[model samples]
Target chain A: MTDAHEIRHEIRIATGDDIVRIRRAVRTVACAARMSLVDRTKLVTAASELARNVIGHGGGGTVRIERLISPSGVSGVRMVFEDAGPGIPDVRLALTDGWSTGQGLGLGLPGARRLVDEFDLQTVVGEGTRVTVTKWTR
Target chain B: MDRVPILKAGDVLLVSIQTDLEDRTVMALREDLAERIVRTGARGVVIDITAVEIVDSFIGQMLAGIAAMSQLLDARTVVVGMRPAVAITLVELGLSLGGVQTALDLETGLRLLGAGPLDGGPSEAQDRR
Candidate 1:
């Protein structure tokens, strides 16, 4: 029931150094949301993975982080990563553990999903991909 | 390029990663650690990650690679001081770190490496001081 005037942070993810910045930004917003340390770590880790994917697979993108207030007055942190690189042809396979297109461990997507309470993925073949995740504070 | 310091402690090398690691920096660490092992003839390495708040798949893979490389050079690698949250995220991410050994703290990690079968005889860890 809170207002939509929550603070939003936008970060450009183009290089490996940006990954660190993404994690730090997520940590700051998570802290502002009054999340526990453990929750904050989870969110930041997820953010790191998503940001890396944007750079490695999506050829670079932007990450948007914001403080969210649910209708029940519950507060949380949300992050959205968007990229215009070659989109995923099969999100299901991409999410499967141990399935990687790159030289990664293939845990990025699913692992990020497990760390957050809300997960949504949008992709268009030959266009781009967008991943959104949210972690609610208990 | 920012480099992580590697300290020599007798038969062991202690590497504490305190900064937010860049990919190139990690790549540099791999090469530097390998050269250091060859130069020092150290039998064990303890990597302290207590100050690191988040570990992505890339960093996780780097740790695993370092352990494997050290083993090839006849050195045992032990990772220690993983925060509880990092541990949880690593598991959820499906990375067990496979071959690398882990301990709760640097002290325990040194002891584990010293007592390892490859180490042989009593620990010379205190001799470095």
Candidate 2:
């Protein structure tokens, strides 16, 4: 049959159009990897929320996607979004629900983190913000 | 954030959501929306969320609550023009609207509520039942 290398793909895109493109790209990548429907939906949702945060709060950012091969022979996906905007002044407050600076309930980051298996975030006031999320399937 | 009045045009009520819908504002909006649903006895309610860039867990919960109240009040509640990011965030947060209807845009939202755009002053909508 065919080689396993034929199944992998990656994506990199800007956070524009309020994160719609990012979600579509995520869905395409996840589907091609043959992820479960539940996992695919969750992954897409997580990507969408994170990308939106970069656009709305961070002003703009970049999104990167990668295919991961687990040590146990499982296949999964990882996505990272980076922004060099005003950055978060208070990361802890921003992560809390009902703590939105604007009209939302502050559920974006916390919600995104919950949907994926691995989540990491790093931000600096003047530097920028980076978020990494991963989902696994054996 | 400026609080808008409940827009009544016939039996349908239009509620506008701005970019600051957190905590107390969310609670207030819920109570206000419920009151309008009861007072107008409208057949349908359309919540325009075009201006909102995010829809966090607390707001999501309140929306679901509004939908339930709408059913009990004999009115249909439809959320319209939700940004893709907001939709994703809500789903990721394990927040489901359950009985509430969603539309891609305001036009569809109003249509789902059985209301058409009126050219003149304001349109009219009344409860069928």
Candidate 3:
């Protein structure tokens, strides 16, 4: 009998050229946990978007990937994308489609949020932004 | 970023959206697709979003604009691989491109474009119009 706690793994990496590595790392973990194709796609896409945000929007940041075992006999993957970039002034407006910075398409944060089962975003005006996405498969 | 010419297959055109598909690219695609739609008289257009990580309001609006433009050319447009998170954020921010056609994958997008399927589809030469 394997302890549920023993199944968890954590990865932390810089948000530079390592963005792809972060994505691959998260994908490997999700695959090992037997996440469904659709679920896996969702997770990967979310990770890619978040990773890009840290690189493009924020100067750079840290990404943490972890596998969570819930109490309800359900398992899920949780990724936290934290950046110390100039924080979003309006979280609500930032999530709107078409409302992008004059730079890229502006779909990064909002799109990343929609790809996961549970999405949480917390940003401080002058500080930075933290986005968390979770995908669960029972 | 280097601009890649979109490919046309029979009556369908395949356009891949990567990066932050914004202004210049969106407009260029719109004009190019419109011209192709007019010249080939194709019935469908497939805009692949598999590589697109962001779809800001402008891009979303531009997508809708392109779809509208395609409609004028008598070709239907389908957007594929819209990440769920992006969809939710768009909805939350009220920047919804609700009227446009969307599919889960490229195969489905191709089907919507009137192609048989990505795999084993009839060998129809892809023409860039």
Candidate 4:
């Protein structure tokens, strides 16, 4: 919200195969943004975790990827994952490590948050969930 | 889903993962490995992930699950060649991969399994090729 963003990609998160595709696409954008190897790996890992969530809990969703540019000219990447499935009942519990509403290890939401610089989550109990993560170049 | 090739070298069953794995692919690898272990009666399993770019919780669980399965089949498992960033992220994610051994690379993984003090019976994880 500080400066500007360029939309890069929109992907469907409906199958296991899409997990790989989502990671690859996020990786492409991250690399193009000149992120460090560690940064790229972190962002991609986070993307994969979220995509799996969309497939597992959300029952399918959409991922929107964008490139961020600050007023000072620094660059970054942002990924928004929106799911129309059952929204979380407790955001705090969902963020807790080792907790899960599904078969996963309960790391997806919390783990993804740590991998990026900015983390935002919005959800309505019956409506859906939207998770946006951003990683800015230092 | 692309299947990771499994090769046999002496008493060790080697698996070099070189692709972005989906959940189904990991499940397939697990089944394939379990069957291979029983079929060959291998003494050790070495999984090289040096080329792998990341290890989210799901993939981390797959690695642990494989090691556990191999242990049950009387084969020691060693995961090798993890990138530094992957290591950092896995730790941050709270997955220690409990009960699975790790090494710097293929040779070290093989050696660890060969001399591994874990449950698998003693044998040379020899490279016959």
lDDT of each: 0.89, 0.73, 0.72, 0.88
In what order do the candidates fall by lDDT, top score first? 1, 4, 2, 3
lDDT minimum window of 10 residues, candidate 2 chain A: A1-10
Q: How well is each residue in A10-95 modelled by candidate 4, as lDDT tens digits?
A: 99989988888888899888887889999999999999999999889888999999888877788999999999989999999999
A44-74 in candidate 2: lDDT tens per residue?
Answer: 7677668768767777778877666666666
Candidate with the larger DockQ of 1 and 2: 1
In candidate 2, position B124 carries an lDDT of 49
**In model 3 chain B, where is the ten-residue run with the lowest total lDDT?**
B120-129
lDDT score, residue A39, model 4? 90
**Which of the predicted structures, 1 or 2, would earn the higher lDDT when compared with the native?**
1
Residue A48, model 1, lDDT: 89
Clashing pairs in 2: A102-B20, A103-B19, A103-B20, A103-B21, B10-B124, B10-B125, B11-B125, B11-B126
**B44-117: candidate 3 lDDT, tens digit per residue:** 98888877654545567778988888888888899999877567555643466877999988776877666865
Considering every candidate listed, which one attains the maximal lDDT? 1
The superposed Cα distance between candidate 3 and the true structure at residue B113, in angstroms, equals 14
Better of 2 and 4 by TM-score: 4
Worst 10 residues of 2 chain B by lDDT: B120-129
What are the C-alpha RMSDs, in order, of all predicted structures?
Answer: 4.1, 9.9, 7.7, 4.8
Candidate numbers sorted by TM-score from highest down: 1, 4, 2, 3
TM-score of each: 0.92, 0.57, 0.54, 0.92
